[model samples]
Target: MYCSANGFPALVVLKMNGLEYLEDWTVEEGAMANLKHLKIRRCGNLKMIPEGFRHVTTLQELVLRLQPSEFFERVQENGLDWFKIKHARSIVTKR
Candidate 1:
């Protein structure tokens, strides 16, 4: 489960689902610089969103659905992973 490697950062929207093997999702450094929206759905085995999100400074909205409870809990406001995504303008979660 890997995306093609490239140097230019132009992606603006990303959606992923059903990636059981994807334990960690990382957008390459300096890549996805324009990414403004992201959605992750039904990825049961992806324990947590990748730590690299802090580098996606332009990310404005994030939506996560059908993820593990523990994973979701960790990303809750004031949770351990909250800081990584705190800069996102909007964060939504659905069970």
Candidate 2:
């Protein structure tokens, strides 16, 4: 949410986990323009990545680890979350 600030720059790599009560996470347009790698681990309360995630053309890798069942399923090849990040060169998911 705070990443919506204009001065916010895309992170080359981001790792997040253990954030309970997290939902409806969203990133603003062009917020992560330079992001290349992302990792989400042990976030059982999260539902899905932001819709803007798809627009991060610079994103090259995405890793999901030890997440909720829904989060895992939704990121599969044809799942809802898949469409947002299908362009990423690599996507790894773990239960």
Candidate 3:
């Protein structure tokens, strides 16, 4: 949660398996501004990505390795496509 709200320039790698240690994605959205490669694993509690992520045009690769049954329980849940990223590396399902 220490990531700056303005923009995290030097932060590239983000691995959140035991995401229980931190808050939800909304609280960590600011840090994602300048991120390149992101790895989101085992965050079953997470519903969706943050809002400001649309501004993060620098992102390249993304790995979504976990999601519980209720991931889309509610309607109007904005999907990951809004990120508008370029050069997607890969999107693999662990199961």
Candidate 4:
């Protein structure tokens, strides 16, 4: 899909069984600046996110399932500050 006309970005919830072909996501980090919400599920092989994913000021929520690491938690803890983001709402991990 494409970004909004205003270019304000979008909220995405990713739910993939595996991340074998997710290299494109890392490669296109710059272009996905408008992404707001990201949810990754069962991506156990995923080691890291795009470099600038932490700087996505428009990012609102980050959700992860089957991820048990400090890195992912750190991203959720430090990155995507809701207060700093005007439209950023909230992050919800797997329950």
Candidate 5:
């Protein structure tokens, strides 16, 4: 999914499922500006988190489940995609 700026401006929490074919998600700067919690499940094909997440300063928590181990690793502290979500206070991943 590709989200542009100002999309879902009032959104505080978002949950997505059945995205097995989704390879990536892009969030443009300022998109989901008010989002605090995000959950993505059943997205086994997703490769990585979008770089634009760094712009989502309001994001507080992220939860990823039922995804590939490599995908989950990318969100770890020393992982490649960590910078995208470092601002989030909590990140949870479950196989």
Candidate 6:
């Protein structure tokens, strides 16, 4: 998805839901630049976090709730998907 420069300047927190059919997502460079917290819920089919998150320097926290256990495993330290969000100060996963 593309986040325009004028989008949500005050949006520090974001929540996404009902993304069962979403297998992948790609973010444009500088997208969600000011987003500090992100909560993703019920995204069972989302295979991995977007690679573009590495550019979101302002992101401090990530929360994954009600996702598949396997999905949670991939985001753990040393896991395959960990690099995408390792910069975050906090990462929480719930299955």
- Tell me how candidate 2 scores on lDDT: 0.82
Instruction: Please provide, for model 1 over 1-95, each residue's C-alpha lDDT reduced to its tens digit, 9 standing for 90 to 100.
Output: 43333433778898987877777665455667788998989888887766667777889999999998988998999887897788999999998
- Superposed model 3: Cα runs more than 4 Å off: 1-4, 21-23, 27-31, 69-95
TM-score of each: 0.85, 0.89, 0.63, 0.52, 0.93, 0.84
Pick by lDDT: which candidate is best? 5
Write candidate 6's Cα lDDT for 1-95 as tens digits. 44654456677898989878877777766677788999999988988788777777789999999998888888999988888899999998888
Expressed as tens digits, the lDDT of each residue in 1-95 for candidate 4 is 22323333343444456665443234233445667676777666555555445456566776667664643554464553322333446665652
Per candidate, the number of residue pairs that clash is: 0, 0, 0, 0, 0, 0
> Which residue pairs come into collision in candidate 1?
none
How does model 3 fare in lDDT?
0.55
lDDT of 5: 0.90
User: Ranking under lDDT, best-scoring first?
Assistant: 5, 6, 2, 1, 3, 4
- Give lDDT tens digits, candidate 5, residues 1-95: 89998888999999988787899788899899999999989888888898888999999999998888998889889899999999999998898
lDDT of 6 at 38: 96
Runs in model 6 deviating more than 4 A are 1-10
Candidate 2: lDDT of 56? 82
Of 1 and 3, the candidate ahead on TM-score is: 1
Stretches off by above 4 angstroms in model 2 are 5-7
Q: Could you tell which candidate, 4 or 6, scores higher by lDDT?
A: 6
- Cα lDDT listed for each candidate: 0.80, 0.82, 0.55, 0.51, 0.90, 0.83
Better of 5 and 6 by lDDT: 5
Model 4 spans with C-alpha error above 4 angstroms:
1-15, 20-29, 70-89
